[model samples]
Target: MSTGITPSLFHILESKIGKRVLVVLDRSFGFEGVLATVSQNPPGIWLSDAEAVTLRSTLGNPYPQVTNRQDKSELFINLSHVLRVEILH
Candidate 1:
């Protein structure tokens, strides 16, 4: 039995492989990384060359600032905590 949605999801993910993406989590934090791989058993994603990022409004600047460009070699994100994903150049 299949709802016929999983393949489309996988296709989208596959197309994004090696591209830069921003993944926002349920928490206030998000990450920017290169899409490495995905695991279906537990519904998680692996990101290489990952960096932690957050958006915060500064006093002087009305626009939210992107901060915390901390570098990380690799990261595994549990899909349950993900809020949304955006493709970044």
Candidate 2:
């Protein structure tokens, strides 16, 4: 959880609030959406307008395919499964 930087994980995630982010987790499962809130009780994040992303390798495809999960408007990500979070522009 320690990134060797001065800022902690909570601070890092906090800085990303109100922005679009791509949160990558275990088994190539990712969530793409806007950061809605951060909580300590469950140590997770809530994403608004969220989409479940599945990263699959394809022949000759350099980029992974992204999916928009309209069925899931919001998602809660457990920090334990999180690998990294990419702040989207």
Candidate 3:
């Protein structure tokens, strides 16, 4: 995946492809929080605390990972792993 600064919308849409999405953990949000996505089933997914930790480590480490914000129990997708972002209503 390409690195650099991208938009949040790009990442949100990427989560739709059934590819394992790497969202940022929103520390501000509480556990069992929810996120918005453009997927056919846009309820998004949930990430456990352990999973969030793993994601954080994977980002800075030698892995093709994405960063995210964690809110206790909820995480948002990082914009880095967004390979191809599109705006489809």
Candidate 4:
């Protein structure tokens, strides 16, 4: 957690297009996937499964993992529910 001036989440997300990221929601849940697109009007992130990343649990931390289900191909996450976003290389 750097104390540098953080940019808007939207701009940060926009810059992550086509990259893998871990998005933590306010509810203590999160997912790892490739950022496909960003919506402004409604505010959401579209994640694709093409280059999906799986969440791993360590120690007692129960990290949410993405499954290979039919409906798991794409995920739409509301920006309002996002608490933090971490870019993965």
- Model 3 scores worst on lDDT over the 10 consecutive residues at 27-36
Q: What's the true lDDT of residue 74 in model 2?
A: 82
Could you estimate the TM-score for every candidate? 0.77, 0.74, 0.23, 0.63
lDDT of 4 by residue, 1-89 (tens): 33232348679778879998777773435766789999876678898873333445556776655432232577888777777777878
Residues 1-89 of candidate 1: C-alpha lDDT, one tens digit per residue:
33323656667887889999888883457888999997665677789999988866766987545666888779998776787877888
Q: Which has the higher lDDT value, candidate number 2 or candidate number 4? A: 2
**Tens-digit lDDT track for model 3 on 2-77?**
3444346446544544333334334222122223334323323433341332233344575333344334543444
Q: What does candidate 2's lDDT look like per residue over 11-86, in tens digits?
A: 8888889999888885457888999998765688999998888776577976555643444688898877788788
Q: TM-score winner between 1 and 2, please give it.
A: 1
Candidate lDDT values, in order: 0.78, 0.78, 0.36, 0.69
Query: Residue 58: error of model 3 in Å?
Result: 12
